[model samples]
Target: MNFANACRLTLLAAIWGASFLFLRLAVPSLGPIWTISARIGLAAVFLALVAQALKQGFAWQHWREYLILGIFNTALPFLAYGFAARTLNASMMSILNATAPIWGAVIMALIIRKMPTFKVCLGLLIGILGVAILVGFDRVVSQTGAALGIATCLSATLCYGIASAYTKLKASHIPSFQVAHGSMWGASLFLLPLFATSQPISTPTPVVWLAIAGLAILCTGAAYLLYFRLVREIGAASTLTVTFLIPVFGILWGTLFLGEHIGSNTLIGALIILLGTALVTGFNPLASRK
Candidate 1:
């Protein structure tokens, strides 16, 4: 990779990694429903403006697929992560997010009605072990809702896996930018009624507003643009390397900004989980060139 593309990849990872930090900061004050609703809603607006600027148009005929993608990819997972952010630290949540591709492999296998190969099976076992280690040893388990929080985070990743499979099965023909743009709007609409009824736990301060803007604009909207661009420029397999880098930035942001502690267990579990993800996805930077 050239230096410019490498820089874009790193920047994308840093932006996505900071999303957890923003969720943790905003969710307590905004509540999960309101926080996620605002996030997708604002992100939709941002992407719409970008689309207009680029003279891009939507595929209105594919609205149904967009809604399904929105539900699984944007609304459900984002809401789950928002809820998880209430009790889990940003570091742990980011690490758990890495499990999405592992879940994807299993889901795709079931979709195809085929048994997983030995390598995938081994990856699945190791992935589960990593989660066990991370949750079993983390001090956050002492918190009241931490168990549910971890489960919620896992469910979010499962939603991501489902979305990936669905996209491959039914929506792969749509351009990535169109899918992203349309789904954000779909998610915003899906969450509208709930957002209307929900109230924030407390009045949001400027910090919360800033966090929401960063989450919606940078993390959701701009990150999608960068992601699709990298896919076009470098190919999707190479772009997947961002998955391995996200947790590093997640841990760094949490420690430096949120003052979250990183135990030995966190490092070990992260390494194991990443290893399993690499195995399951067959992601290799060197091989991607072939």
Candidate 2:
């Protein structure tokens, strides 16, 4: 890629990384389900307007696929991350989220009937080891909630992995922006009942509303636009690099703005996770074999 595109990619990464911070800020005021629903719903609106203005052909041609994508790509993962952030630091949650691509490769191999390459196998091993270390540290310190939060993040990432694979194989034909809009609409539908039952409106504050606005406009809407553009320009692997950068930006932002510490083990694990992901996603042994 050229220098401009590289900078754009980095900016996209920063936007996504900042999302963890915003989620941390927003979730405390607005509960997880409602927050996710609102932001994604707003994002959908933005996408809808853009699509209409552009005269883009739009339809939920495959309702089932859109539903599945909504669940895997946005609904499940978004809720998981939002809920987990209540218990875990954004730094920790973002670090754990870097596992999405690792899980995605495995899911792709299984569902698509492609065999797992050595790089993917190695990445799986490394990722598990890194997670075990995090869990072990938490267990020894009696921070069980943090461990569970990380596990929640992993579950979300697993969904992301499956969704990533599925999107690349099945939804590539659709414009990425349209896919984003459709997924957001589906997610909004799934989340509406939960938001109402959870009774978030009764509990929300002005700060919460402001947080929701930033989360919707800056993080979800703008970030997704950049993300879709990056994926179309550079393909999925390059797009997924934002996964690694998110944690770094999360930790830095948390430290700077929230007075959170950068623990040694967290840094070490982050490095290992990134290295493993790079090995898995950046190089394909199958391609070389072919």
Candidate 3:
């Protein structure tokens, strides 16, 4: 927890937090498929240039691995969250996204054939409770995007969590930068046909291009670099803490820039979700051993 890593944490939080806002802006102009495609495409190009400059030529040794990561981590989750955000508020979407660690823990347990630590199991239960509290009552009491939007957010997180477990396993042998670059390029390729069908360029604007640029340079490129650095400096648990702060800035930007409303339920849900994340990432049954 050095001062420098702390600052990096804050920077990563702000950058990712603002990602939802960028999506919101770009989606209106370009639609979800195109907006996401543009970002991943641009990010791939930028990362490729950087890698070449650093003498890291494109490595296709694990093209299959990168392709899977791209599909799960980049394409599927991005589209799910993007479409979901059209209906769900930023705060709510972020709250749901925070459940990634819980999903990760569960996936790990399943894949590794080892019992999750007690604390991890408990954290999973608590996280589920929080999601229920957030979405259950809303679904029962209202018809305002409670089902579709919430489902999208949770599904997106599920993809993220599964991808995370896979990344942890595969990235053990792959160069981290190559992983990032390959994932971006694979995502771009996956989205290309969809982008072609939608064809956002048919009705483009300068603002839309700017949104794509921000998504590419800031959210995708810069964010991934800091993400890796933060993981190294703070460990995965602390690095993922950025997820908690992302929603705060996302909600703020949504309200300030997009004029989106912040509902009372959304705020309550956010608090509960943060509590769940804290439990999942910070808790350890074996803490006494340390």
Top model number, lDDT: 1
Backbone clashes in candidate 2 total 0
TM-score of each: 0.98, 0.90, 0.89
lDDT by residue for model 1 (162-215), tens: 999999999999999999999999998899999988899999999999999999
Q: Clashing residue pairs in candidate 2, if any? A: none
Q: Which predicted model would earn the best TM-score?
A: 1
Residue lDDT tens for model 3, 1-290: 77888788878887787888777677766778888887898999999888888888888888898899999999999998778766666656766878887787788889999997776777777777778777765432265655787888888888988898998887667877888989998898888889888855357678778878888999999899889877776676667668777878877877888787666766777777777777767744244122
- The C-alpha local distance difference test score for the whole of candidate 2 amounts to 0.77
The reply for model 3, stretches above 4 Å from the true place, is 136-146, 283-290
CA shift at 150, candidate 3, in angstroms? 1.5
After superposition, which runs of candidate 2 have C-alpha atoms over 4 Å from their true positions? 138-141, 201-206, 283-290
Model 1, stretches more than 4 Å misplaced?
288-290
Task: Order the numbered candidates by TM-score, best leading.
Answer: 1, 2, 3
- CA-only RMSD, every prediction: 0.9, 3.4, 3.2
lDDT of 2 by residue, 37-132 (tens): 888888778878877887876676866667778889999999999888777877777788888888888888888698787877888888887776
